[model samples]
Target chain A: MTPQAQVVEVRAGRTRRRGRLVAAAMAAPAVLVVCAVYAYPALSTLAYSVSKIDLSPRFRIEGFVWLRNFINQLTDAHFWQATWITVYFGVMLCLLTVVLSFLIALLLNKTFFGRGLLRVTVLLPWAVPPVASGVLWVQMFHAEFGFLNGLIRAFGGEGGIIWLGGSTIALHSVLVTEVWRWIPFATLFILAGLQIVPKSVREAAAIDGAGPWRGFRHVTFPLMLPVVVPVVIFLFVWAMKVFDTIFVLTRGGPTRGTTTLNFLTYRQGFVQFDFGNAAATAYLLSALTVVAIAGLGWMLSRSRRLAGM
Target chain B: MVGTSLARRLKRVLMYAAAVLVLIVTAFPLYGIILTSIQTEPDIRSRDVAFVPTYIETEHYQRIFDEASGIPVAESMVNSLVVALATAFLTVAIAVPAAYALHRMSVPGRRVILGGFAAIYVLPTLLFVLPLFIAVVQLGLYDTYIGLVLPYTAFTLPFMVWIMGSFVRAIPVEVEEMARIDGAGLRQLMFRIIIPLLRPGIFAGLLLGFILAWVEFLTPLLFTSDLSILTVTLGLFRSTMDIAIGQLAAATVITALPVILITAIFQRNISEVVTAGVER
Candidate 1:
């Protein structure tokens, strides 16, 4: 090749390399901030899980014990209790949210009067801050002067069930508040999914003389499942990590009936000042989240395959 | 035919009735809170509560502003506004370039970065907050606005990048190539050409990030104990016991007002963002 052509080729290679360098430079700030603020701390917490850390006089990381923290947490009865409670809460919340959202979506999918107004009203609950929702429900569940009891009395019934006072009842009360906050979000998702269903398919189902239930079961639901499955997983993960509403409403109280893994981590780190144990709990919760998400994904794919068959 | 028409009419009526029932269930708490905020203190405390306020009083709101109420309502609101706005600005500013690099430029490990961000998004906040709480103290940033903004920005960056990157990817590569051929530098191409196209995604990201940071309770609760650093959500928890029910209701309404207004104004954009994030 001529010297001029060789020089041009070398220059092109340099420019390409320069472009990649520029791209990396542009991306560096976000990467650095995430690393410094999120990734570093997360890794250090994992480190804390294996070592003894205390922050009384000053922050100090003692020698690593190497799995003792995990062993301790694994053996603790309270850990098992919190795990069971978390799984139950997550599952129940996910089921209720998805089912209720699907129902609401069906209601919303129809062309009806005042549909726009109803849509806005449904979203209002979700717009309220979770902490405020917790406080609002706490007052509503007040035994002496709450609106719930007042309505019950106005209807000529004996009132004043201790909604947030009993152990088992308090967890359900928290569940109610969570379900209230989440339903609107899930509804919007499912409603969006429903809007994408083709008109011809429904018409064909009708022409086939299938009733509404059968049409929905055979055509509409299968189409919506792919959309709904991800939402279900999202809600399940969200419910498992819930801390704000329960913290405000019950504070994981009434004999720890409502304490999930997330709350347990908070209780250990902040209240008990056992940073080691807290980190261990946090790690375990992360592991569980990974496992749950993976398992859910596998199950969803398997179900889709089975349905296809 | 007549029987079918009647059945259709009946079904319509039932649908409307069910819709109204759902609306009432959805809106009752908001209505109750507003009513409580305007009701007399005696009405709130009494067993026989007034379903409708006989006299709509502003005493609760007045008490919230009163110096004797022992709550710094204005200061906390300002703190919340500062932290939220700062977080939104920082997140978008950092995310826009990163998104451009990931989507428009030939960046290595793009998939890995995206996957890592999605994973980070799902992990419990406590996982990071525990070590962050200790680190913030050691770094002497505890109880500072910077401390709050730092974590808020970090937590919000991944989602912002994801959203903005989707928008960036939608811009035709030919447009960017033409701009570059015309001697536009990378910065000029991004700022002069790409940003105008990315307006909706940027607005959605800012609003989402701001709302998330504004509503956040745990981070502030853990990181900052100073009264002045408390946001509105954290402030509500502080005076939950000390304040009367009426004043607490007022506080709740005040805390929720900005969010309500934003949602009302940007309802379509917000919903679009949410649906887009999920659909992808």
Candidate 2:
């Protein structure tokens, strides 16, 4: 190698190193947009929880009120009521959606006539935006002209039942709408898990003493559980953060009967302009979601290995 | 052996029946909307619910175009489309390069980066809403298109990067090294060679990203106030406040059309994309 070629090569290598440094520098800014716009706000939320942030022209920030908002949130009847409602709603929604979706998946997994068309239709409600689904349900629940009222009256019943009016039925109404919208997602995930379950396992099970129920119980259901556990965690966290369906359908209403934690956060932040309490409420919700999902992920991974073995 | 085989066939027949029943229940509401959208007022109002369409009325759809999505509908739909499209474009743009970097270079802490991204992925939907809302208002971009789209890209990016990142890593590292030896720069290798090879992954990622933006209920609803961002979801929202069944059902079908058609076209692949999304 000549000295000139060596110098040129050395310069090229140095520039390449410099180029990586430049890209690395740019990396923070590029991704800082993500962190700033997304994660930073959540961090800011934590700060707001401990500090008092009043929304005036200046939106004053007073320091450190450790767990005061949480105490107040816990003390507030509305907050506790919202928690029970949320937990109840989440449990019911997850269980029903999982069972329904699995049954639906079982039916659709085989080769049959018009399977393709049924698959398309199944994706329809899931595909629509949740806000849209909420709105459609509200319309369907309408009297004198709603499709649902029409169905009820057609079945030889007096059809003037108002589903969303009272506080008792109001929350249940929202639950129904959520189940309607979310069941398809549950079905789709289980269906995905079903795809890889070996056909021969079932055949072998059937070749011996097992019946259909026993075959699935021993061979397929256990294999499907690893995937289903993660999905349940997802749906649980998702249901906790559900705001659109509630906002569109009930607006925490008749008397704040159906308010979840997320709905309360929105109410405090924007509707009532209580930024400090709102941010605090959000952090509470976020903390719960994080712990639940992390815990579920850990458990699922452990079970995956055990199941695989 | 023959009797046992007959029993197996019978069980399979029962399975098909169960699937059909589930489909009928699921399809009825949707069928109601499409039928309601096309029915005359009296036909819809008649005591009998007709499964068949007697007459086709294009009035509400025509009104959507003719009257210019009057009074907030047009603005909401346009806002939604703008937000969704921008989200799809930006997410793909940023994810491809970053994913390429992670895929190609010996980046330190790759597993940590991957895990951090996964942890962030499952953060609940509106947990960031309050702080972000304040930030948007603070930045003086509240109610602006960019305000919504920028955050949206943030939400979907991690999921995209992780899914597409793992997929890009799945491609053999040798191909890129060969391209590098043959006088291809990083840009050329990414655009000319790697991206084409990643078309399936990119296509699937883009689909999920677009759907995330389109079907997103909470974020857009929170941010936009003054200028009506015309959206089908917003149209359904009106149904909550008022009956206007004809108009709402029409809007419902309109909102649901793109999603239904797209899912139908890619039914085989969507489950994989969404299921893979769960890993992150």
Candidate 3:
């Protein structure tokens, strides 16, 4: 190689090195912030889960009792109940929101008068804060003067129903508020998916003497699964962690009916001031969440690949 | 032909019917909240539910703003504004450079960094807020604007970075190359060329950050005890117990207004982002 060619090659190498350095410099701030926020807290929580935290003598950490906190919480009946409630709430929320939103998305996909206005209104619930939505729904569910009862009375049914009073019913009422808030997200996402399902595919199904229902079942729905599955997972994860609506609506309830694992963790930490138990519960909840996501994600990907998607 | 036409007509009618039903279900609660706020306390408590106010009342609104009532609605709004705005600006400032670097440059571990951001974004806040609360206290940042601002930034950063990454990638690399060829420095290329093109993403990120911080309940509830620094959610939480229905409804409406307006104005951009985000 000529000396001048070697010089040009060396200059190119230095420039590339400078570019990498600049990139690192640019990414430094975000990397630092993420570490301070996520890493520190995560490590401390792990430590706290292993150690007993006592507040009586001014917030001191007592001797390490490894695995004791976890064992105690696992054995506790209330912890199991909270776990059951979280799973139940998340599954129901996932099912109802995905189904309802898919139907709405289909409707919205069709060209119709006032479609634009409907689209904007669909986003309203998403914008409303969960705490505020709780406030709104709590008023709506009021036994005597609530609009729901008034509507029931006007329609010749008995007016007074304690919509949020019963232990069984309050969780369902909180479920409704969450569904209301989540539908916007699911609906919008599914609608976008619907648009991507080619017109030719539908027409081909029709040409094969398939009815609308048959076409949807075979062609449209299967194509939509890729979008729907991810949305379902995202909604489920969010539903599992819902706190604000519960905080405002029921405070985990009339009984422990709505005391989800997330709420239970809050109660143990803040209300009961048992940081050790709370931290342990939090870790368990996080582990459950990570496992659920990974498991569902893996299963879905396998199914998709098998189906040749 | 007639049979097919009639069926088509029926289909159209059903579609519109479903659309209207969707609209009512989505919009009714919001309307109810606004109506409840404007209705008199007596009317709200009365058994007769009037969808429209027989008597329009603004007293609930006035009382919320009146500091003499001791609710601190006004004070907390200011606090929320400060925290949310700080979070928005800080998030954008940090996220933009990082996104540009990650997308535009030959960054090592780019995929890992992207995946890490996505993972952190998906993790429940419950997992972090406990330890975060303790750390905030330990660092002596508790009960201050910075305390909430810092955490809010961290929460919003991952999202902003992803969104802004797409925005950065949308700009052709040749644009920056040409600018460099013209002897423009990296700073000049970014500020003069890329930043101008990134306006829409910046706006979306800022709006989203502001909304997230404004609506946040958990962090502020745990971090601060000072009434002056209490956020809107915490203020509303306190008032929910003793406050009148009309007054509480007013507060809810007040809390929701800015978010509603932002969502309405940026519906298209946000919809694109949402679909892009999930479809990723």
Candidate 4:
């Protein structure tokens, strides 16, 4: 080639490279922030998990114990209990949230009078901060002065329920508050899922003489699975990590009945200042969450594949 | 034909009934909170509580603002606003360029960075909160707006980047190419061509970041002990015992109202952004 052409091509290459450099420069602030925030914490958590944190004047890593904290946490009965509770809570929360929100989404998806108003109303609960929801529910679940008890009494039943008092009962109450708080967001997701379901598909199902239930089961629900699967996994992960509502409503109380692994991590690390144990629990919870999500995703996709969807 | 019409009517009735039920279940607690906030303390504590207020009173709201009540409602609200606004602004500013780079430019390790961010997004704050807390202390950022603002920005950054990246990707690359051909530098292309096209996503990210930072309880609870720096959510927890039920309800309403108002006003955009990736 001519020397001028070669020089022009070389300049273009340099410009391209310079453009890339500038783009990278633009991304540097965000990349640095995330690394400092997430990457650093992640590494520090790993380090703290293996070492003993001595709280003398301030938080100082004394030395490495290498898996003793993990061993201690794994062997602790409370850890096992928290594990069981976390699993139960996450599973139950996923089930209730998906089912209820799906039903609500179905209702909201239909063309009806005041549909827009109802949508706004349903969406409002999600906007209420979890702490506020916790406080709201705490009042509602109050045995004497609560709206729930008042309703029960108004309906001719003997009133005092001690909703947040008993171990199992308190967990259930927390579950209710969580479900209440979660339904709106979940409904939003499902409604979005429902939106993508085409009219012609439903018409085809109807023309094929499929009843409403069959149409929903075979056509619409299947169509929603793509969205539903991820939503379920999201809800499950969120449930396992629920700290604020539980912290507000029960404080993992009524005899540690509601102490999920997340709360346990908080209790161990912050309340007891057992930073090592807390880090271990957090890591374990992360591992369990990852496994559960992976397993659930596998199961969902496998089932879909087997079903030939 | 009559029977078919009857069946259709029944279906409509059932649908409306179900819709109302959904509304009631979703909205009743909110209504009850508002009701409780307005009711007299004696009425609230009464075992035979009326769903409708027996005596409507603004005393609870008054007490929240009242200095003797010791709630610091106004100050905490201001703190939350400042932190949330700062977080929202910072998150969008950082996310937009990062998103453009990821979506538009061939940055090295782009896939890995995006993947890491997606991973971080799915993982709970529990995974990072412990060490983050320690780091904040060591950096001498504890109990300060910068401390809360920085973490909140970080927490919201990955999600904002992803959302804004989706927006950036939606804009035709041909537009940027044309600008480049016109001798537009990368900055000019981004500022003039890209950011204008990314307006919807920017608004979504800003509003979402604000809401996330506003509602955040754990970060403030863990990081700040100074009364002046206390966020509204943390303030709700602080006076949980000493505060009367009516006053607490007032605080709850005060804390919850802004988000509710935002949702009401921007329901379409907020929901669109929130459910962005969910649709097939």
User: Which candidate has the highest DockQ of all?
Assistant: 4
Question: Can you write out model 4's per-residue Cα lDDT over B27-119, one digit (the tens) per residue?
Answer: 889989999999888888989878876667999999898877676899999999999999999999999999999878888889999988888
Task: Sort all candidates by DockQ, best to worst.
Answer: 4, 1, 3, 2
Q: Where does model 4 exceed 4 Å of error?
A: A299-309
Models 1 onward score TM values of: 0.97, 0.89, 0.97, 0.97
Measured over all alpha carbons after superposition, the RMSD of each candidate to the real structure, in angstroms, is 1.8, 3.6, 1.6, 1.7
Residue-level lDDT tens digits of model 2 in B17-110: 8877878778777777788888766776665666678789988666654554443555556777888888998888788766766656644555
In angstroms, give how far residue B140 of model 3 lies from its true place. Answer: 2.0
Indicate the docking level reached by candidate 3.
medium
- Per residue, candidate 3 scores C-alpha lDDT tens digits across A126-227 of 999878998999888899999889778888889899988877899999999999999999999999888877889889999999998999988888777877
Which candidate, 2 or 4, has the higher DockQ? Answer: 4
- Candidate 2 residue-wise lDDT at B119: 71
Q: Candidate 1 local accuracy as lDDT? A: 0.88
DockQ of each: 0.75, 0.47, 0.74, 0.78
Instruction: Give every collision pair in model 1.
Output: none
lDDT of 1 by residue, B7-74 (tens): 99999999999999999888898899999999888889888867876778999999997877777887
Q: Write the number of the candidate with greater lDDT, choosing between 1 and 2.
A: 1
Candidate 1 TM-score, C-alpha based:
0.97
Mark the 10 consecutive residues where model 3 chain A has the least summed lDDT.
A299-308
Taking the tens digit of each residue's C-alpha lDDT, what string does model 1 give over A1-309?
Answer: 899999999999999999989988888898888888778989889999999987779879888999999999999999999999899899989998888889888999889989998888888888898899988998888888888988888888787788889878999889888988999889989888777667788879989998999998998888777778888888988987899898888899889999999999999999999989999999999999889999889877875675462
Q: Model 4, residue B61: displacement in angstroms?
A: 0.6
Q: What interface RMSD do all candidates show, one decimal each?
A: 1.2, 3.0, 1.3, 1.2
